[model samples]
Target: MKYSFVIPCYRSEKTLGKVIDEIQAKMSEMNHQDYEIILINDCSPDNTWGTIRNLCSKNENIIGINHAKNFGQHAALMAGFHFVSGDIVICLDDDGQTPANEVDKLLAKVIDEDYDVAYAEYAHKQHSGFRNWGSHVNKVMTEVMLGKPKELYISSYFAAKRYIVDEMLNYKGAYPYVIGLVLRTTRNICNVEVNHRERTEGASGYNFKKLLGLWMNGFTSFSILPLRIASYGGSAIAFIGFIYALYVIIRKIVAPTEYLGWSSTMAVLLILGGLILLVLGLIGEYVGRIFISINNSPQYVIKNIINYDSVENKN
Candidate 1:
């Protein structure tokens, strides 16, 4: 069967070529020929695009796509998915940490088990404590949002049947978390244990702040839990205020000599003020998503596109 591999490259110049070489070797080992590799450049400042161009010149099966701006990895993946023409599509990071050879195993699971998607689960994660914590938060949020199995491993490395890819592409949202999209699309998902290696070079693109932002994005985009929580909180606060007012009325009626206390008034004011802010923040989050969607913002811009005969030949 024909296969397409979509490798999303950011500042991956350090190991992109190595990953490609391993994929080629794996394909050769499996005696597979009807495959193409699509390298998407997410406007890396490094020589990642240059390396991809050099590889494309040497290999007919390799195609290159350059973006006008740096969209995140998922946006680049979406762009690559749009151009793929294969029975199956596999997405792998260009960082070389994920073993390209193990792709065959994922493919086997998809084919043999008749699964829509097969993903790699690292036998042991080689990331720091903070990263691991962030991953766990992401997983929990995904489970709460999409209602998928909590154990489904969401990795950049996965092989999907053509229909799954098509279904994913049909999702047109600004905040497109690929793992969530896949889970929403199909339930025939399986995983294979694979090795995860340390990064060959360069620090990760996501720092603590960026990771927190991603977490918020995933939470807000997939679920309305935050909004619901805010609603419940406001209602609870209002009920407490009503009870307090009733207490004050009873106290005033029972003890005509007693005066209203300043401390109690201040406490009530502070609680109400805090609740108002919390509710506003929740509304802001939902409004922000709607504003972003209505603007028709492109997830990733294409500064340039390479290897498409139609565009290249036209010029």
Candidate 2:
């Protein structure tokens, strides 16, 4: 069976070459020389594209994709997914944290046991505490918003069948959440424990800003549960207002000399006003994303492509 390794690269000039070497070595050991490695240079400030071009020139099996701009990690992955021709597709991080040799573990679940998707479950991650905290929140958000299995952990490294990749590509949205796409497709998923290594190059590209953007994409793009929550919140707030009004009426009747101060009135106005604005903002976000998607914004513009394939990508 042909295997395709899809790597989304950003500022990976230091580690990209070693990552490819490891992948080729492991694939050769498995006697799978028909495999292809597709690396996407995500408009990094570094000379990542130059390195990708050099690698592609040396090995015809290595395909190089250069994006017109940095469209984030999921978008870059989608760009690579569009051109992959493997019967089974595997995704990896540009960093060397995920050992290429452990890819066999994910492949085993697919080859030995028939599974549609396999995710790499780290025994213990080597990320910073803050990064781990962000990931934890992201994991919970996936479980709550997308109804993904609580036991299933989604990470950068995973393997999927060609059919799954095809289904995911059908999504034509500005924001693409990989796990959200997978959960929409199938429930036949497995998890494999793998070794996680420390970073040997530059710092992680996933910082505070990117993580916040990813969280917003996860909430706003794939799920309507946030709208539902807003509706429920509105209802609860209305009920509280009614109860407060009843209490005020009772106080006026029981203690005729008592006067309800402007403090309570101002407090109520602020609370309701804030809730109304919050709900409106959420609706506006959804509508804005829909308009952008309808406009047919290119997910990732291709600056250039270097590959030995028969097809040409000049757009």
Candidate 3:
């Protein structure tokens, strides 16, 4: 069974070559003869494509894909997924945070244990405090939005079978969340402990805004739970307003205030106004995403591809 790696690269010119070398050394050590490495450059500003071209020239098994623009990591992975022909496909980061040496741990589950997907569980994650917090929030959101298992850690580092990969590629939404796609596709998932190395090069591209965008993708793209939440919240707010209105009416009948109760009236108006606007915004998010999809905004586009077509992996 040949193993194919679909690695997403963005501004990783400095470290990508080293990562490929590590994979070559490790896979060779494992005596894995039939394998291919497909690298997708996510339109990095740095010379990532040039480095990928160099690597492809040096290694016959390497397949390089260049995106027209940066379409986020998951989209880049999808581009690579379109061309893999291996029995098992492993997804990893361009940086060495998740080492290629840990590939064996994930591969063992699929090859020996007969697991459909093997997610890498880090004993001690090497992310910064802020990034770790973002990840924690991301995990919780996936649990709530995508109905992911509470204990199932959905890290980008995972190994999946070709069938599952095909199932995942069926998704054509404008906002693609790879882990969410996998969870929606299958229930046979497993997690394994692996070593996590701290990034020794450029910082992660995820900012506050990007993290928020990812959260939106997980919530708005694959699930309608947010719309349901808005409905529930609006209903609760209306119920409270009804009770408040009854109280004010009773108060006016019992003893009409000399002051027309302007303060309390304004307070109720403000509260109800804010809640209505919030609900509308939530509704608008869903509608806007639908409109975008209807207009056919592409998830990603390939500007130039090299060393991918002729290289075939015979299963």
Weakest 10 consecutive residues of candidate 1 by summed lDDT? 306-315
TM-score of candidate 1 against the unseen true structure: 0.92
Clashes of each: 3, 0, 0
User: Per-residue lDDT of 1-315 in model 2, one digit per residue for the tens?
Assistant: 888899999999989999999999999898888788899999999999999999999987788999988999999999999988889999999889988888999999977898999999999898888889999999999999999898997888999999999999999998988888999899999899998999899888888999999988988988999999999999999999999999999999999998789997998999999999999999999999999999998788988988846323311
Q: What local lDDT does model 3 show for residue 238?
A: 87
Which regions of candidate 1 are displaced past 4 Å?
Answer: 256-261, 310-315
- Listed per candidate, the RMSD to the true structure in angstroms reads 2.7, 2.2, 1.4
**TM-scores of all candidate predictions against the true structure:** 0.92, 0.97, 0.97
Candidate 1, overall lDDT?
A: 0.85
List model 3 lDDT by residue over 171-193, tens digit each. 88889889888888888899999
How many Å off is the CA of 79 in candidate 2? 0.4
> Can you give the lDDT of residue 67 in candidate 3?
91
Question: What lDDT is reached at residue 126 by model 3?
Answer: 92
The lDDT-based order of candidates, best leading, equals 2, 3, 1
Residues 1-315, candidate 1, lDDT per residue (tens digit)? 889999989898879989989999999999998788999998999999999899888877787999988778788899999888889999988888889988889998999889999989998998767778888887887788768686788878999999998998986778777877787788999888999998878867777787776776677777788788888888888898899899989999999799899997998899889889878887887898889989988777776666766423433
